[model samples]
Target: MFFHPMDFLILIAFGISLWAQFRVKGTFNKWVEVPTRTGASGAEVARALLDRNGLSHIPIEVVRGTLSDHYDPIHGVVRLSEAVYYGRSISSISVAAHEIGHAIQHKEGYKALTLRHRMFPAVNIASGIAPFLLIGGFLFQALSLIGLGIIFFSVAVAFQLVTLPVEFNASSRARNLMIAEGFLYNDEENGVKKVLGAAALTYVAAALISLLELLKYVMIFMQGDDD
Candidate 1:
């Protein structure tokens, strides 16, 4: 369990994840200095987008973190980071629109997002329990326990896979909506794409890493069975 041939590939994916993280932060910070031509704050832009989509009932809240913004479907609120909530920069507008995109997805019943939401509870439990099961199975050389752990870990991997489409769809919706609503100028589209694209890379890298890890576990389980 300490290492395997597959560890090299997982390490490569991990490096990509780190690089994606670096790019997202760099892109966000760079765009944050470029003010939107409309001078609209992030919250204001989010409110307008929500209202335009006939989602006026949704409220926006300021949260305390950098790049920690998210839409809470249960409580039905959009939470924006402090920088994204009040800033008038391109980053602020891009992030705000992207989250509003998720709200719109919820309203429209986007299949991928809905599936992701449905998988959340089980994935949460499976992820929490999988590590212990796998560790114990390996220590005891129990193929059955390892198989069970693999099943649970696969659930988590599936969740990560499902998340990719949800994030990409949100970014797509945001770009189109941003253009149609005149939230960004024509030339400013590049900045929006850059910011959103960089952010999307993080999700892709995460999914890739999870997939590779899942494969590694499956291989190990198969080897144990053969032995």
Candidate 2:
């Protein structure tokens, strides 16, 4: 079953995702040791950037879990993990800047960010039910059902695609702000870049995986229709 022709695409996507995760973790671990010259904790950096951008109304909160940091657009909060919230390391500050960049996007009504937010609801529904629809279609030889599954799953892929720009723009904003604000010294830029670049790869990997899954489903449906 695993040796199906279409499975090759999935295997490649899985390999890419694994490498992305490894790179992100390895890069973060390497830079986590390097303390920033500014000596600002992640929360501190997030607060300063947000306040300067007139986003002082947004709150910064510490959350549990490793690499679970994110901005809650609905709540207008930037949430960081324990290490990021307290540690004054390059990884910490870089991550903090990236999250705050998302807050800035929300404040400025970035088109991609706004589109992503709007897509979230439909994407959520499609993501949950699409798998079952596909499985049922395959088991029962229902081409129409399979097509429906593909249509639903495509929304999720679209969401992931839209997310790429939102994420990359956030990182760009983070890097630019950090440089202009002198949050990092000349020598510290490389470390921050490594950290943020690694983080961004995870998003790219996610989008790729989603796209591959959608392709796999389409291939399956097409093949079955031919038979």
Candidate 3:
């Protein structure tokens, strides 16, 4: 039995994405609990940054889940995972500061972040339709449906592209704030860097996976149209 090239590509992409996620998670776990010399909990580190930035009113709450930490711009809340909220490691501090960086972006009206937020609705709509379009196109041999899938996936790709800057900037801000605010000493800074760098890999993996999936659909549609 012969397998389609597009199917093979998707399999490879999914495998790579899973591997990347595992690697990032391993890196995070290995570093997340190693206590920082300063003995500051993730919550303390987060509060310091927010206070320094005059965002003291913004609430930091622990939300249950692994790697669930994020800033909710609409509600002015920073949600940290239990591991991060209670951990007193350089990794925890770095992750906390990173979420706070997003809060800062919200406060300052960062253009890319703003644009990404605005595009969320369209991106969500596109994502909801993508799988149906792809499957329907294949089942019915409809090039138009596949083309629509490609278009929707393109919107998702754009959202991912916009996300790159927002994430990278947050990491950058996190590192700088950690140093400038004395959250991590010089030697401890490396640990923070490693943790944040590992986290960034997951995002990179996601974008790459999305791109590969988009390519797979394009190839399928091209083959169908040629038939």
Candidate 4:
């Protein structure tokens, strides 16, 4: 309820999560200064990739905010941030292509992405409910409530685990297609990798943090039960 031994590792993972966020922004800005050889804007790159994949029916929209780009599977649209939508830098193309990778995943019925979508609705509700359940259980010394919280929280953790492959697969698709479609040169591959890799670390850190906390809760629950 208060603190567990696993809290130490959770703190460490949380620190890594912060650093991963920082790394992604720094890497993006660093590569954003370096233009691609062809100097193609993100929107242009997205369109080319979409059309080449026979996904011309899907539309690209400019979304506001920094690094806010994503593919809307529900809407069947790709949204790019202003930086990725208009800039002609390596960061722009890499980010744009990554989102397009999600679009490709949607098109191909990637099992992980499909599972993530189906889990999202229930995970959303459970995630929101879990915190309150745990807090209230601790406050009232209710093992049943704690157990219920753990059950709900597990769903959220499972969702996070499922997300990892979806993200990695998207980055993999983006990198391969970026090279094959001539969006970036072979030499510039390092920059794309850095940008996408930094982004991937954030997800890894998040999943690690959640996993540690779930373990901590289970440990505490068992300790109390044994007592």
Better of 1 and 3 by TM-score: 1
Candidate 3 whole-model C-alpha lDDT, 0 to 1: 0.87
**TM-score for every candidate vs. truth?**
0.98, 0.96, 0.93, 0.98
Candidate 1 deviant stretches above 4 angstroms: none
Per-residue accuracy of model 4 over 1-227 as CA lDDT, tens digit each: 59778989999999999999999999999999999999899999999999999999999999899999999999999999999999999999999999999999999999999999999999999999999999998999988888999999999999999999999999999999988998889899999999999999999999999999999989888988998
lDDT of 3 by residue, 103-165 (tens): 999999999999999999999999999889878877887789889989998999889988988
> Candidate 1, 136: how far from true, in Å?
0.9
Give, for candidate 2, the lowest lDDT window spanning 10 residues. 1-10
| Winner by TM-score between candidate 3 and candidate 2 | 2
- Rank ordering of all candidates by TM-score, starting from the highest: 4, 1, 2, 3
2 or 3, which is superior by lDDT? Answer: 2
- Candidate 2 per-residue lDDT, tens place, 1-227, comes to 22456577778888988999999989988888988888899999899999899999999999999899999999889999998999899999999999999999999999999999999999999999998888888788788988999999999999999999998999899988988877978899888888988888888888988888787788777777888
**Which one wins by TM-score: 3 or 4?**
4
User: Which of 2 and 4 is the better model by TM-score?
Assistant: 4
* Residue clash pairs of candidate 4: none
Q: Model 2: how far is 50 from its true place, Å?
A: 0.5
lDDT digits (tens) for residues 128-208 of candidate 1: 999998999889988888899989999999999888899999999999998898888998899999999999999999999
| C-alpha lDDT of all candidate models, in order | 0.94, 0.89, 0.87, 0.95
Cα RMSD to the true fold for all candidates: 0.8, 1.4, 1.9, 0.7
